[model samples]
Target: MAASDVTVGVIFLAQIFVGSLGNSSLLLHFLVLDFTGGRVRHTDLILKHLTVANLLTLLCRGVPQTVAALGMKVFLSDLECKLLFYVHRVGRSVSIGSTCLLSSFQAITISPGDSRWAALKEKALRYMCSSTRLNWILYGLLNVMFPVVMTGNWSHRNITCLKDFGYCSAARHDTTTDSLFAALLSFPDAVCVGLMLWSSSSMVYILHRHKQRMQHVHKVRSPKSSPEPPKPSSSW
Candidate 1:
């Protein structure tokens, strides 16, 4: 193997090791809390789910890339490549959905009582669970297209041939259709990121206002300790 290939392999392996360790630690912590009857918060639930999704992502994307980087010949079959890509895509989608859910949940929970979304705050915990399940299902179904559109090119095992025009059997795949689908699949990620930004911003504003209000109250209730202006000493 070339020196460059060996270097790539080492990097991939390192990524796998570090990513696995962190995700495993997070999962372990969540499990410990669950078993000990600790009050698992709503965010905790989302985090636990995220950890699992991240681990799957790392495994699917990292391990395969690592093997390939190591210059392993004929290590994976066509079916295996399809499966790996599918799982990686699904895991990534789930992570995005979970993050969006987490942000919205926090926003709703911290919203002012009189806000329009206040009603959602009461059901936040229940919603968190249901939303996560829905996200998984939705993304899973959507990504089923991955495997369907994808085929392994055994002759050039390094590349995948994605079905586009429905007629061409050659190694070259349709780039336009592939790009379109990719953009479509990325919609959820974009939406989730926007939601997170909005929610976090609103939360920050609310807290800042609350802090100001508290400060005002403290000033009103507490007597001013500063010495009065010398009682206009000389004017008298």
Candidate 2:
């Protein structure tokens, strides 16, 4: 294998192993404690659903494809290759869409009242997994045509933004076409990342301000009462 391929292989395998184990534990947690037990309520269900979607993504894309990289040299039947390609591609895309939906929902939740999607605030705050129906629908719709849109045999996408190897690119020739697809692919992801970062940072700032206020209050309450000047010697 070429050094680059080897590097890809190693990195992919590590992600596979780690993502699989971590997601499995999360799945176990959801089933054993979150869902089955009465421990889950309200927003907890949303967390459970998100974890399950992520777990599905990891298993579908990470583990099998990682293993395939190790033994990819062996020639396979046409049907086998297509099936492998199809599963890996569809699964990864679904994973991406699902994760994006999860993050977007979170962002909507934390956004202030003046935000554009402020109407979604109430829905976002509630248990999205159980109380809200839209996220699941969005996840399904985002991925429904993936298998159709992608051609399994190409190995490379006809469209542009073809960075990852396993999945075919969307562009075949024109750089403009590729750039458009790249923008499409990146916009939602970038928004999700940005929203999460902003929301988390805002919370940190709020906490810092709160701590400063408490310190001020503490100082006010326990003013270092100055000792009285020493009395003149009474012996006089």
Candidate 3:
């Protein structure tokens, strides 16, 4: 094998191993908590979902690339390719949405407890599970086109217009169809990313303001240095 191929294989292997290990650890922790009747925080629940999604993404995307890089000639059937791509897409989307949800949740949790945001915070905490469930459902439906478009490498030879994805290929759609699908996929991702950024920025701003207020309070409450009484005259 070429040196580049060896390097690629090693990179993929490292990614797959490290990513799987970390995600699995988080998943096991969550599972143990659930089984032992431990109090699981709502944030933990979101992290659990994110862990699972990360695992799926690593396995689906890394394993194939690793095998290919190693000069392996494994062949996947059409069904296998479609299923793999579909699962990978869903996992990726879920990961993004989970991150966004987690950030937004934290922002809401830390916001001032005024009447304006009190109800919003309560609703966020109360519907955390429902929100996650809805996230999964929405993304699952959004990427439903994968199964229809994806095909095994073997089929790519016969298809004139196909986009190769190493272990699989996707049939090329016309410009209009491609544009429509691209819009559909990009819309949710854009929204999720935007929300994540906005929430993260809000948290930073809130923390900064809090820190300034703390400094101000500390300065105000700190004892002022009293002036020393007039010292005795120097030795005559």
Give the residue spans of candidate 3 off by over 4 A.
Answer: 232-236
Write down the lDDT of every candidate, Cα atoms only: 0.79, 0.57, 0.89
Query: Candidate 2 lDDT (Cα, whole model)?
Result: 0.57
- Candidate order by TM-score, decreasing, is 3, 1, 2
After TM-score superposition, what is the CA distance of residue 45 in candidate 1 from its true location, in Å? 1.6
Per-structure clash totals for the candidates: 0, 7, 0
- Badly placed stretches (over 4 Å) of model 2 are 1-11, 35-38, 41-43, 73-123, 130-133, 153-176, 226-236
For each candidate, what TM-score against the reference? 0.83, 0.63, 0.94
lDDT of 2 by residue, 105-201 (tens): 6556655567676888776665454433564554455444344444433443344443333433222437796577567656655665676676666
Candidate 2: worst 10 consecutive residues by lDDT?
162-171
Model 1 Cα lDDT, one tens digit per residue, 165-226: 12111244578976787788888888888998998898899899889999999999998799
Better of 2 and 3 by lDDT: 3
A best-first ranking of the candidates according to their lDDT comes to 3, 1, 2
Q: Could you give me the TM-score of model 3 versus the true structure?
A: 0.94
lDDT of 3 by residue, 82-103 (tens): 8888899999999999999999
Error of 2 at 201 (Å): 2.6
